[model samples]
Target: MPDYGFERIGKRLFAEHLVGGNFGNMSVRDGDAGFFIKKTGAYLDAPGEPVFVPFEGPVPKDASSEYRVHLAVYRTTPYRAIVHAHPPYAVAASLVTDEIRPLDSEGEMFCPTIPVTTGAPGTQGLANAVAEEMRHNKLVIARGHGTFAAGATLDEAFLLTSLAEHACKVIALKKMFLQ
Candidate 1:
C-alpha cells in the first residue's frame, strides 16, 4: 500500500469533524492490480497500514465495507484517489435537499453544486450511483450517508471533501439563521 497522502488526509478528516471514530474510508487506485484501502473499522486518524483489493477474485474480508464504491469509481473514472467521509452538515443537508448549492465563494468556485445521491451504504446501488456521478463531478453525497470525492491524488480529493463540509456547513447555518 502506498501513502497516497492518506495519513495526512485522515488527520484532516478527523480534525475537521468530517468523520467520527472509524466510520469513513478512503482509497487510492493501483492500476490493473486493484486499490489500497483502509481496513474495516480502522481508525482514520491513525491508520497504520492499508489493505489491497484486486479487481478480480475475492475482496479481502478486512477491507473497508465501502470498498465497493471505491472499486466502482476507479473502474469508471480517471480519478486516482477517493475520499468517503460522513460530514455532519453535508449529511444533514442531504436529508432535506436534492442538491447543495453553496453560498460561500470558495464553495461556489470549487464545488458550486453538490448533488445528493440516494442508495444504501455498502451496497451495489450506492456504488453505481456514486461512480456514475464521479465520472462528471468530483464530489457527491450519498443521501444521509456521506460525501464521496474523487481526484487525481489523495490531496486533491481531500480538498474536495473539506470544501464539501465547509459549503454544507455554511448552507446549513444560513438556513438555520433564516428559520
Candidate 2:
C-alpha cells in the first residue's frame, strides 16, 4: 500500500464505521511486495500505524487470517483495494438469506447481486469460494461471517461496502413493512 493511500483508506474506513476497535482489515499492493496490511489487532483509529508486508514471498505466519480472501479478490479483480467489514445490516441479511438480490438502484450500481460464500474460516478453500462468488459483483457476504468489498481504490471499496450495508438495511425495512 502506498503510505498516503493507506492513511487515507484507514481514515475513511474508520470514519464510516467499517473498521473500528480492530474489527476489520484493509490492504493495498505495494510494488513487488505483494500487499501491505494492518498489523494484527491494530485499530483503524491510528491510520499511520499499519505494517506493510511483502506478498511476493511467503505470507508471514502471523498474517491476518483473512489474508487469503484479500489476496484472492485482488488477483481476480481489477480492484487495488480490498476491505472486509462486519457491518450490521449486511451481517443480518447474510444470516437470514443465502442470496441478496438487487432490490434498489444502489444495489444495482454498487452490487448487482450479493452472493454468500460458504466454507470454514481462515482457509484457502473459503477464499476460492469467495472469489468465485465475487466474479459477478463488487460486494459479497461471507455467510455468517462478514462482508467484503473491492474497488480501484480503498475509498471506492469503502464506498461500495457502505452502499451494500445501506442496501441491506433498506431491504430489511421493506421486509418489515410487508409483514
The candidate maximizing TM-score is 1
Residue 112 alpha-carbon offset, candidate 1, angstroms: 1.5
lDDT of 1 by residue, 1-179 (tens): 44577778899999989999899998998887899999999998894788999988899999999999999999998888999999999998999999899999999998889999999999999999999988889999999999999898888988999999999888778878999
Off by over 4 Å in 2: none
TM-score of 2: 0.86
lDDT of 2 by residue, 1-179 (tens): 23536656666766776665777778776554467666667665574555555655677765667888877876776667778787877877888888887688978775777887777667898899888877777778888777888777777878888887878888988989999
lDDT of 1 at 34: 91
Name the lDDT value of residue 11 in candidate 1.
95
- C-alpha RMSD of candidate 2: 2.2
lDDT (Cα) of model 2: 0.74
